[model samples]
Target: MNLAGLIFVLVTHFLAGRGVMAMFGIKENKRKTLALSMIIGVVLFHFLPVVLEVCHIAITATSISIAIGILTLALFLPVSYKLDYSVLKITRPSFTLYEALFATLLILMVIPSVWLCYYFPVFARDVLSGPEPLAEYAVREHTLINSALSVDLTSTNNHLKPPFILGLQVIYKLLVHPFGELWLSIMVCSFLLMFYTLIRERVHALIVLFIMMLFIMMPEIYGYMYIVLSDYPNMVLFFLAFYYLGKYLETKQANTFYFATFLFCLASSIRSETVVLIGLIVPLLLFSFIKDRIKPGVIALRLGILLVIPYLLYYVWMNVFVANYMHIQFNTGEQLSVTSDSVNIFFDRIGIILGPMLFSEHARELFGYIFNIFLFTLALDLVLWRKKIGLQARVMLYGIVVVLVGLPLLGAIIPWFDINNTTKRGVFKLFPLAAFYMANSPTLLQLSQAIKRFEFPELTAQKNAAPVMAQQQKIKKKK
Candidate 1:
């Protein structure tokens, strides 16, 4: 690889890995976000290598390495103050169906977008095809595919397999190796499974499910559905981890906690940055466990077990084994510029990513149509949930999860850049989780309730009402 090519590849991985590390500090599970971030870094670095030639700037090995280092540092600065495990204290747990519906619908909406983006070849077609043999692309991954499967994983990659990408490969192999038409089928199932779990009530299931199936309303999901990328599955992992965690929070049962923890661990392995999601969740969990000002010693012990232990293992394995022994660089000089607008570059691409009829330009029109059909049905869901769930609706719980998870995700996506990096990577993986949350949005309730007034059956009030005690007492006195 030439100097420019090397620079791009290295910096990309570095940026992505570091980004995941930081995200882990918050969510404790952002491996996919981390892996995809590196991809973004490489894409941005290699975009215009010749632009350097025209500028008379010579790319050097020293500059490339330093750039990666600085960018990594930049990613961690946000967490510098909040690095302590104290934040792991758990908090009050609640539920609301709206949140679940929101996340489910958002996932359905965005995966289709990601697929269209790839299949149509708008963003980066050279993806698996490998870049036109360049010299200075940064980082060096994709070596595993060459070594293990003996397939050219470097076609879309210059060197290494970012964890998210690796997880995608693993998931694909487990489900169906040599991906074909069935790719989308698997994608649909993974997403559907997580959302379906949120449907505890049969009354709202069909209504929420139908809204989620409206994939065309959201552009990002439409683009993701058909591609052989990590975004779809990564989002699936995110939702599953959180949904299970929400269950654990509500019940605090050992089985629920164990399953939730396992899913979170699995998610971290799937995408490094997902570690952030897991980490952030632990502290939020701690908030719940720490109330009543539990004995300091006890709190510390719980915090250690709940938040610190698993993460330390993940960190040690990733740095000591993956990045070091793997001998792969994921960043470069241009890609690293700390003072530059990496986040901006990420958001700028959103338009192209989402703007394509039943696509981006007419999102307003598409949304109006979708809401109209589902309006009454959604209303029925809320009424049913009120009767069934009473004060403990999963929707309220979902809103809390969104608030915790969506902030950083929001920070990552608001800015745009053409540079391939973490912000966009996280953005891409975020949509499915968002859809899953939306599946339980109040919008679903409104529609479902209306349906009850029309097609669905409604229970009648008791005809033989009992007299109030006060009224009975007055009648006896008169007699």
Candidate 2:
């Protein structure tokens, strides 16, 4: 039954994704289209229950299932009529022996992580205090329950946090009944698959697979995979937004732009802190249009509608509905004031927080080694190929720097919690992007090219020698 529910949910997302891709006329790249579709589908699925709740409709399992079914059919029908079935087929790519071995190694590494999601208990403290109670209340009550008003569970002051993941849990509970843990596994696996699909375009298949291993093996990343936390979901959404933005820059495709904007908004909705991505993304979009000598007004209008409007709506909704219900106030007086001591502490902890070293003893044991490896790779890439880095990569690097620097400043100003831990996890939100850019760095690309030259020197020589030999023969004939 658990397996059935998983399959059902996965298929529904795929179909809905394909429909979204078709609607946007995104047909150039198959893998990207499929990946973006799945992501958009998940976002829409999350929003469906919210819309129902807002309309004063009951959110029972049966109603949710029927709504999803109707949406799937509505989307699939037109897509089927318009798109050729062959476009959806997944053809296998031929691989060299080295590639095959690396691919196998990648798969082996991921299997343990996926298995851990199933075998390990859902034990993240934040999950128990945060999303779990919300999911339970929503599923049990057949409506969105006011956490502050509910007596059954303690509210964690996260009522304004987006409900996308909670809505997913509700659907999973309805479908699978009691097997809640399986849903966590499924969500984690889905993220891995999407990561692979997005990365394969920029890096070699072997390198892409290796990066996946690195991501899942990271203690911080895999720890949250099975836990009902918002961090992993926010990571996925941030990566998706940037992935599409990179695509838009490279291909100058409007559909990719639309997708990027949508994902950005969704990411901000998932985590308020992710609103910072707007500052990182808008400049890139403007640069793309200006570089292409395209009018910026059109880009500005589209962004205003797609990115700004959605963010504003979510902000207002959070303030009016969720915040009011939870008795939370959003005011300037609540801001944390900066002091000399706070500044000193922020500077002192900056190394542990933004650096690769894990500060917590338990987290250090689990994630220390993997985090150091990432740090080494990042340092190596920047030192060796700083000049060869592409503009898109440079933008991402700048964004990372801004995040690392800006977050500490925020922590200094607002001494709300342990600045060390806050900076550690907060900066972690940029890990996927950091790893991705590092993997596709010019140094890595040059290394891969050199490896190809060494492995197939004969092929390389034949191509180069052909032109020289032709010239020599021509001289001999002339003589």
What total of clashing residue pairs does each candidate reach? 159, 0
**Per-prediction RMSD in angstroms?**
15.7, 4.0
lDDT of 2 by residue, 13-118 (tens): 8888788777767674665555556666666677767766766778887788888888888887787788867865778876767557766775776577566655
Supply the global lDDT for candidate 2: 0.66
Full-model lDDT for every candidate = 0.44, 0.66
For candidate 2, the per-residue lDDT at 362 reads 63
lDDT of 1 at 449: 59
lDDT of 1 by residue, 391-436 (tens): 1235334433543354344344333222234333544443344444
